[model samples]
Target: MKKMIALSLLLMAGMMLFARGSKESGKTVVEIWHSNSGPSGTAFDEIVDDFNSTIGEEKGIVIEAIYQGLANDVLTKVKAAASADISSLPDIAQLDATACLDMRNADYLILPESADIEISEIHPAAIEALMSDKGLLGVPFNASSLLFYYNKTLFDSLSLNPPETLDDFAAIAPLLGEKDSTGKVTRYAFAGVPATYELGAFIGAQKGLSYIVDEKNGHMGTPSKVLFEEDGTFRNFLGHWKALYDTGFVNNITSGISTEFAAGRTATMLASSSSLTAVINTVGGRFEVGTAFVPMTDEEATGGVNIGGGAFFLFDSSDAVKTVIEYFVSQDVQMKWAEDTGYLAINTALYDNPEYLAFLDENPAFKVATEQMLQSNPAVTSIWLPSAYQIYYSFQSEIRAVTEDGKDIDEAVHDMATLIQRAIDEYRAQNID
Candidate 1:
C-alpha cells in the first residue's frame, strides 16, 4: 500500500508538469476585427496567413482576423464594445479614416508609441490623415486619394490632354461633349455628384491651404466651427464648379458613373484611387483608361488630395499585436497589398524598392496617385468630425441644389455652412464632456 501511494503521487506530479509545459508552449492568439472585403479581404487574409506560417510560427503567435462587415459597421461595433466594456474590445481593429475622432476620444487605445512600434517610414500624408492633437491615432493600412479618370482613347483622338486645373476642365468640357439633335447633351464631359470626399481636395487646393473646419480641420482639437465660409474656400470652389456646370456638360448622376464612363457615354469622372482596379476591370479594354491628379482649383493652388480609406487601431499593447502591425507595414506586404487592391502603399520605402519601381514602370497608370500624393502639401487632410457622415451627406445635398435645382450658389454655400455647424454643435452637446 505504501508503494502504490508513492507511485500515485509521482503520476500526479508528472501530469501537472505536462500541463504547465503545454500552457507555456501554446501560441499567443491575437484577434483582429477588420472591414476589408472582396479583393482587399483576400489580400489581407494572404498577409495574415503568410505571417502565421513564417514569423508567427517562429514567435509562437497566431493572428486570427475576423471580418466585421463594412467600415461603418466595424466602427459601430467598436464603439458599442467600448461603451459596454473596454476589455471586450478586440486586440486590434481596422476602421475608416472618419473614426479618427472616435479613436482619439477613446482612452482605451494602445498607441504605437506606447506599444514601442516604429512608424517613421510611413508617408507623411498618411500619418497626417490619422494624426490629431493626441498624436498618432492609428496606423494607416489601406489608404487612397482621389484620381481623375478619363478616356485616353477619346482624348488622344482629339489631341487633348487631361485637365490640370478646374479651368482646364471647364475649357475641355465643351470639346469632349456631344449633343443630340434637340440640343440635349448625349455624352457628358463629366458625371459625378460633388460631395465631401471630392470637396476635401477642392477646399485644400487653395493658396496657403484652406481647411473646412477650424482647429486645422479638427486635428489640433475638437472644432467649434467651420472655416469654409469665413475663409471663402467654399465660395472660391463654387465659382469654379459653377463655371463647369454653366458649360452644361456636367451631370449629377450618382449611380452608374463607372458604367457610363466605361460605356463611352462620359468623358471624365473623379473617383477614389482605391477604385482604380475596379474601374479598369469594368472597362475591360473597351478603351484605354487614363488617370491623373484630381484637377486643382487653379494653377497657383498648393494643396492636393486628402488621404482616404481605413487604418488599424490597437486596443492591446501585446508584443504579438506590435509584430503583426510591423509585418503589415513591411515593404513586401505593402507592395503586394497595393498591387492586389489598388490602394496606395503607405510605406515610403517602396518607392526605392527595385521590384516596386519595375512594377510602376510596367504599369504607369498606378503611378498617378503616388506622384500626386508626393506632391501634395501635408496640410491637405480629411476633416475629422464626429458628425462626418451627416456633413458628407449635407455637402452632396447642397451641391445638388446648386447644380440641379438652380439654387443660387451663395445661398447653397450659406445653407451648407449653417447645417454643418448645427451638426457639430449637436454632436458636441451629446458626446463631449
Candidate 2:
C-alpha cells in the first residue's frame, strides 16, 4: 500500500510538471498589424510564418500580422484604436516616422535597449529619431533614406556619367533628354518625391543645415516657426522645384512615374533605397539599374534622410512588449531584417560579415544601395503632429499644385508659406505651451 501510494504521488507530480512546462512553453502569439500590402505584404507574411515556426517549438512566439498600406496608415489605425481605449491593440505595431512622433508622445512605445536588441550599435540618426523627450521609444525597423537610382544603360548610351551635383543634373538634362519633334522632351532628367521631402534633401544639402537645430536637446529638427516663415529655406526649395515643373523640365506624372522609370522612359528616379528591389523587379531585369548617392550642391553631400517608414511600437506595458521590441532591434533579427528587406541594417557588424559581402557580390543589383549605407545618412528633423502632419500634407498639396499647374515659383512659395504658418498657429493654439 505504501509503494502504491508513493507511485501515485510521483505520477501526479510528473503530470503537474508537464502541465507547467506546457503552459510556460506554449506558443505566445504576438499579433502584428501592418499594411505591407501586395508583394510586400505577401513576402512579409511568409517571413513572419517562417520566423514563428523556425524554432520548431510548439511554444514559440507566433507573430500574427494583420495586413492593413504603408507604415503610416497602420499607425493611423493604431491611433484610432488607442483613442478608443482598445486593449486588444496588436502587441506589436509598425509605424512610419510621422507616426513615431505620435507614438512617442503617447507613451505607446518602449526603449529597445531594455529588449534583447543591441540598441547602441545602430546608426545614431536612426536611434535619434526613435528617442522621445524621456527615453528611446521604439526600434528603428525597416529604416531607409532617399538615394539616386538611375539607369546605367541610358547613361552609357549618352556618354554621360552619373550626375553628382545639382549643376551636373542641370547640365546633363538636355544631353540625355529624349526630345520630340516639337522640341519638347518626352523623357525628363530628374523627378521629385512626394511630400516635399526630395526637395528638402536638396535644400539641406545646398544650405548645409543640420536637420535638427541642436542634436542634444531632442527638440524637433525643423522649427515650424522657421520653415513656413518669410524667405525660409523650405520656401526657397519649393520655389526652385515649382520653376522646374512650370518649365516642363520636371515631370510629375502621377499615373506612371514608377512604370515610366521601370520602362526606361525616365532618366532617373529618387526613391527609397529599400525599394531598390521593387524597382528592379518592376524593371523585369531588362537593363541594369545603378544607384548613386543623392546629388548635391556642396562638394560633399551632408543631407541623406527620408521622411517615412514606421518605427516598431510596443502597445503593451508588460515585460513582453519590452522584450519583443529589443528582439526587433537585436543584432540577430535587425541585421537579417535589414538584409532581407533592403533597409539600412541596424547593426554595423553586418557590413563586415563575409556572408553579407558574398550576398552583395552575388546580387549586383544591390551594389549602389548597399554602398549608400557607407555614404548615406538618416531622416531630417522629426515632426510631431496635429499641425506638423497637417503642414506636411498641405505643403505637399500646394507644392504639387505649383508644379502641376505651372504656377509661378516665388509667388506660389510665399503663398504656401503663409498657408502652412496658419496651420501651425492653429495647432499651437489648440495645444499650447
Candidate 3:
C-alpha cells in the first residue's frame, strides 16, 4: 500500500511537470524552484509576474516560479529529481547557503560567468558566501545576517545599552533580569539556543575570524575535518557562553523565543535579520524593538557575523534563465525585495541609491544587517559542509549538555568535535571521489 501511494505521488508530480512544460505560444519556458513563503513568497511572485509581463514578454520568455516548501525540502526534491530524471529538474533552484557544498559535489550547476552573466554589482560578501573551489557556486538572492534584538523599552528603563560583546552580555544580564525570592528566574535577560546559525556568528567573531572547517571554510577545497578542536575557537566561544549561562539570567530555550521577548519575559534575543519584520509585528507596538550587530566574543574581537539565507543555482544555461537571474539581482528588484522581506539586498549599488538611502533612513531596523555585512571581515564566510544539518543539531545538543546536564565544558566540546568530524568523514566517504 505504501509503495502504491508513493508511486501515485511520483506519477502526479511527473504529470504536473509535463503540464508545466507544455508549450505556450512558442515562448521559451523557464521554471524556477524556490523555497520562499509568506510575504517573501508573495513578493517573489509579484517580481516574477513583473518579469513575465515586461522583459519576459518582450524576449518571448515565460518564467514559472514554483514554491517547493522550505530550503531543505527543496533540496531533497532537487536531489531526487537529479537521480530520477534530469529532465524533470527546474532551470533554476534557490537553496539555502549551506547547500553550496552539496551542489558543488554533485556538479549540478552552470557558472554564470561562463554564460556572460555579469555579477559585479552584487556585494562581495554575498558572492563569497556562495563561492567554492570551483568559483561561484550560485547567485545570492535572499541574503541575511545574524542580528542582536533587544527590547528598547526594557533597556531604557534600566538605563542600559544593547550589549556589544559577550562580556557585556554577562555584565548586564543580572541587571536586566528579575528573579523570585527563591532565586528562580522569572524574567530572563536573554532567551535563545545557540544552534549552528548562532554558533557560526560566535565562532566567526573571534579575534582573527575563526572557521569551523579548514580549506577556508570549505571554499578552497572540500573540507575533510573541522578546525574548532585544534584552533581553540570552540573553546574560546564556549568559555564566554558558559559565563553567560552561569549568570542565571539566560534562558536556553528555543521555543516561543519571540513570544517570550514580545511578552516582556525576555530582554533580548539573537536571531536572523530576516525575522526583523515578524518580530516587530509580533510585538504589536507594545514595546519598541532595536536591532544591532551580533555581539562579538569580546572587546578585542575583529571578526563579524557570517551571511545566512539562500542563493539561486542555475541548471539550464540559457539566455532566458540568465535574464531572469539578472532581473532578480538588479538594483530595483533587490531594493524592493529587501524592503518587503527584511533581507539584505545583494546589489552593493543599492547602498548608494538615493531612494534606498531614504528607505534606510526611514527604516533603521533594516539598515543594521546591511551595515554589518559591509563591515564583515573577508574571512567570515558561510560554512559549507555536506553534514551541515547534522552539525547544527550537534551544536545544540552539546551546548545543552554543558549548560543543563552539568557536563564538563571541555568534554562537551570534545564530544561535539568528534561527532562533527565523524559526520564529515561519513559524508566524504559516501559522496567525495
Candidate 4:
C-alpha cells in the first residue's frame, strides 16, 4: 500500500508535465512570497508565469510569486503578519539562515518528506549554511560568491596583475594604497573585509575553516577569545588587519568607501562576484574593469556559497503548499532564474551543458560572476543567524572605535566578543525551538 502511494505521487508529478492549462479542473493557488525586485524580479515573475502555464494552472496548483524587499525586511514584515504566525501559513516564503531556522524551529515549516533536494545541483557549502541543519527549509535563489575585483584601468596604468594568494594580496597593498598630504592613507587598496561578509570568503579560501561542523547541528562556534580556533592562521589574519588599520592603509570597513572605489577613489576591492555584473553594467561604458577569483590561502574556495541573495521558500500549509514548493524549486524553474537573471543556475547540470555554458562565454561579465558562484563554499555559517547581523554591527563598531576613538584592540575585541556572544545566546533562546 505504501509503495502504491509512493508510485502514485511519482506518477502525478510526471503527469504534471502534461498539464498544459487549457482545462478548468486545474487551479491550485499556492502563494510564494519572495524578496527579488526590479528587472530580476520581473524575471522571477515570468518564471512563475511559465510554471503556471505548464503545471499549476492545469492541475489547480497556481504558484503566486510576491516581491518582498530584502530578506531581513521581509522577515520583519512576516513576523508582524498574523497569517505568518499561524501554523497554516502561505505555501512558500524566501528566507535566509536566520529566518529558515526560526520558522523551522517553531515547526512553522514542513520539510517535504519526498523533497530530497538535488543537492548535487547545489554546492555543498551552501547546503551547510542556508538549508536547515537536519531539514531543508528552502531552495536556493540568486546565490553568489566573493571575488577579487580590481580597478582594471588602474592596474593597466600601473602594469599590475590580480592577486591569486594571500601573499599576493599583501604584496599589492602598498602599490595600490594612496597617502594624503599628512602621509595618511586617503584611498585604500582592498575593500572586502570591512563589510558584511565578515571576511568569510577570505577564511573559507583556507583549508578546514568553517563555523559549522555538522549539517544537523544548526549551531556556530563560540570562539573563546579568537573568532577562529587558536590556530596561528587566525592570529595572522587579525594581526594583519591590525597593522593595516594602524598604517591607515585600510580606513573604511564593510565595503570601505564603495563610493570612493566606484569613483576610482580606491584601487582594489573584494566583494560579491554578483556585484561584478552590476558594477560592470554600471561602469562598463566609462572604465575598464578586471576580476579574478577571491584570493586563497591553502585550499581552493569551493567550501560552498553563502546564500547572499535570497531564494523562494515553501512556507508551511498543507499538501497543496508542498506541491507549490516542488514546482517553484524544480529544475525547470531554477533554470529560468539563472538564465534570465544575474544568478547562476543552482542546478549543476546547467554547468555541464555546452549550450548553457556557451551563453556564459558570450557574456564575459556574467561568466566571471558564474565562475565565482561556482567557487562558493556554502550559504550558511554555523551558529549564524539574522541576529548575527547585530554582532556584525557590533564588530564594525568596535573596529571603528578602535581606529577612530583610539580604543585598545584588546579591550575593544574583548568587549565586542562578549556582546556578540550575548546576542548569540539571546538569539538562540528566542529563536531556537
Candidate 5:
C-alpha cells in the first residue's frame, strides 16, 4: 500500500512537469492587420512565412496577418476597436502616414524606443512623416517617393542626357516632341497630371517656400497653417508649369500618363517608385527604360521629393509583438521586400547592400527611384490640414484649369488660395482650438 501511494504521487508530479514545459515552450501568437492586397499582399505573406520559419521559430513567436480592407478601412476599424474594447485590437496594424497623424494621441500606439529601433538607419523624411509631439508614432513600412522615368532609347538616339533642372527640361521639351506643319502635337515631351502630388513635387524640388507652416506649441493634431497663397514659390511654379503646358510640351492626359509612357508616345514621366515593377512589365522589353533623379530648380537647389506610404503601428505592447516589428524593419527583410515588391526599402542602408546594388545595376529604373529618394523632403502639403483630401482635390481642379483650360495663372492661384483658406477656416471653427 505504501509503495502504490508513492508511485501515484511520482506519476502526478511527472505529469505536472510535462504540462508546465509544454506551456512554456509554446509559441506566442502575434496578429497583424494589414491592407495590402493582390501582389503586394502575396509578397507580404511570403515574407511573413519566411519570418515564421526562421526568426519566429527560433524566438518562439508566430506572426499571423489578416487582410483588413484598405488603409482607410483599417483605420476606421482600429478607431472602433480602440473605443470599444482595447483587448480587441491587433498586436500590429498597418496605417497610412496621414491616418497615423489623426491617431497620434491614441494610447494604443507603441512609440519608438519601446524596442531597439535604429533611427539613424531610416530616411529622415520617412521618419518625419510618422512623428508627432509624442515621439515616433510608428514604424515606417512600404514607403515610396517620386521617380523621373525617361526612355533611354530615345535619349541615346537624340544624344541627350536626362534633364538636371527646370532650364534643362525647358530646353529639351520642345525638342523631344513631333509637331505637324500646323503645329499640332503628334507626340509629347512629357506626360503628367495637374494634380497636387505632381505639383507639390515640382514645388518642393525648387526649394520653394513651405506650403504649410508648423506652429510651435499648437495642437499636435492640427499644428499647421496653410501658406500656399502667401508664398511666392507657388506662384512661380504655376507660371512655369503653365508656360510649359501652353507650349504643348507638358501633356495633361490625367490618368493616362503612365500608359502614354509605356506606349512610347511620351518621352518622359514622373511616377511613384512603387510602380516600378508595373512600369517595367508594361514596357515589356520594347526599349530600355532609364531612370534619373527628378530635376531640381537649379544646381544649388536644396529640396527633396515627398515621402508617402503606410506604416506599422503597434497597439499591443508585447515583447513578441515588438520582435515581429523589428524583424520586419531589419535590413535583411527590408532588402528582400525591395527586391520582391520594388517598393523602397525602409532601411537607409538597403541601397548600399551588394545584392541591392547588383539588382539596381540590372534595373536602372529602380536605381533612379533610389537616387530620387536620397533627395526626399517631408510631404508637408496636406499632412496637418484637417480637410486634406478636399483641399488637395480643390487644388487639383484649379490647377487643371490653368494647365488644360487656359485659365490665367494669377487668377487660378487666387481662386485656389480662396478655396484652401475657406476649408481651413471651416475646420478650425468646427474643432476645439
Candidate 6:
C-alpha cells in the first residue's frame, strides 16, 4: 500500500512537472532553488502555477522553482555558486533556519528589509526566527513543530491514553514494549533520532532550561554557549534516555524508527509536524495513527514545542522576484500551501479563516501541529552559529556512545559541551572578523 501511494504520487508529480515545463512566451522568468520534495514540493509547484496564471500574467513574470536537494545540500550549492558566478545562483533559495547565518555572512542572501519587503503579514515568531544582525534573514516557509505520534491500535489494546507528561509517557512506555520468553525484545516503546530537533523539544518541555545563549541578549556579543550541561538538563535527560535504552524500552537506531513504528514493532516516536503526509502514506491502513502535543515534563505541563524547519531566503534583487515573494506570503497563498503541504501557515490570519477551520475539521492530525505552534518557541539551535547543525550531529554521536556504548554520561556531556564551544568559537572568529 505504501509503495503504491508513493508510486502514484511520483507519477502525478511527473505529470505536473511535464505540464509546467511549457513556457509562456514573453514572460520574465524568476528561478527558485528549493529543498522541498514529495507532497510539499508538489504543493509548491501548484502554488507557482497559480501565481503564474494570476499575478504572473498581470505582471508578466514567470516563477520557476527547481528542487536543489535537501536543506544542507542547498547551502553547499549556494556557497559554490557564490564563489563561482552570480548567474549560477537561483533568484530565491530555501535555507534551513540554522544555516541562514552562513548565507547572510557570505552575502549570498539579500535582506528583505533592503528590498523593502513587507513582512507584517507573517507570524511574529516566524519573522523573529529569521531575523539577524541585519534585517529579516528569510521568509519562513514550511514552519513546523515537534509532535508525539502513536499507534492508536496499540494504545487501545493496552488501555492507555495518549501521554500528556513525560512521567505519563515513561509510565506507559514500558507497558507498550514486549519481549519473548527468551527475553529477546519483540517490540519497543519509543524510537527516534537524538539530535537537536528531538532533544531541544525535550528540554523546552521542561522550563528553566536554556539550550543556547544568544550573544546580543545577555552574553554581550560573546559566541553562543551550550547551556545544557550548565543547567543539568542534558545530564538528567540523558540519564532518562540511557535508562530507557538499557531496559530495551527504547531503540537507539538512527534510522527506521518511523518504519518500525508503522510495522507495529514500536509504539510511539517524535517527528516533525511536516512529516504528517509522509507518515500517513507510510502507515496506510496498517493501523490508526494519532498525533498529540509532544509530552512535557511535570513542571511544564503546558510546555511549548520548538519550531524547526527551513524558510525561503531571497538571493536575487529584482522587483519581479520580490513581487513573487510577496504573493507567496499572502494569506490566500499561505492557506493553500498549508492545506496542500501540511505545513503551518505563516500568516496568522489564516488560522481564523473559515476555509482553514473546515480543513482542520477534516484533518485533525495535522491540526495538532498548528495548535502546538501557537505556544511554540523558536528552536535554540536555529539561533546558534551556522555550524550549529554540524555540532548537533556531533552531540548526537556523543549521546549514542554514552547510551549504546555505556560511556560515562558526565564525561560525555562535558566532552560534547567542549566540542560545541569550540565550533561556536571558530564560527565567531571567522564571521566576526
Candidate maximizing TM-score: 3
Off by over 4 Å in 2: 1-25, 56-59, 111-118, 182-184, 210-224, 228-232, 235-248, 297-301, 306-308, 317-319, 330-332, 376-379, 385-393, 397-408
Q: lDDT per model, in order?
A: 0.88, 0.63, 0.86, 0.59, 0.73, 0.76
Mind giving the per-residue lDDT tens digits that candidate 6 earns over 66-146?
898998888888888889997798888888756665766666678787777888878876776666666677888778777
lDDT by residue (tens digit), candidate 5, 1-433? 9999999999999999998875546789898999887557778999899988998889999888999998878988998988999999998899875575466657677776675555678877788766666777888888877678888899999999998876688888888888889988777888876455555566655553254434421225555455555665567777666666666777766677878998888999988677777777789989888878777655544466766667888877778977888788889888877776667887878767888789888876677677666655554322445555776677777777878788877787778767766765675676653
Q: Model 6, residue 99: displacement in angstroms?
A: 1.4
Where does candidate 2 have its weakest 10-residue lDDT segment? 212-221
Shift of residue 87 alpha carbon in model 3, Å: 0.8
The collision pairs in model 3 are none
* TM-scores for every candidate against the unseen true structure: 0.91, 0.81, 0.92, 0.77, 0.83, 0.88
User: Least lDDT summed over 10 consecutive residues: which range in candidate 4?
Assistant: 212-221
The clash count of every prediction, one per candidate, is 0, 7, 0, 32, 0, 0
Q: Give the winner by lDDT.
A: 1
lDDT of 3 by residue, 82-127 (tens): 9998889999999987777778877667877676788999888888
State the displacement of the C-alpha of residue 70, model 2, in Å, after optimal TM-score superposition. 2.4
Q: What is the lDDT of residue 394 in candidate 2?
A: 62
Cα RMSD of predicted structure 3? 5.0
- Candidate 6: misplaced stretches above 4 Å? 1-24, 216-224, 301-303, 378-381
lDDT tens digits, residues 136-235, model 4? 5556666655556778878887788886665666677788788889887666776534434645554443453443222222433322233433233333
- Sort the candidates on TM-score, descending order: 3, 1, 6, 5, 2, 4
Q: What pairs collide in candidate 6? A: none
- Collision count of model 3: 0
RMSD of each: 6.4, 8.0, 5.0, 10.4, 8.0, 8.0
Cα-lDDT of candidate 2? 0.63
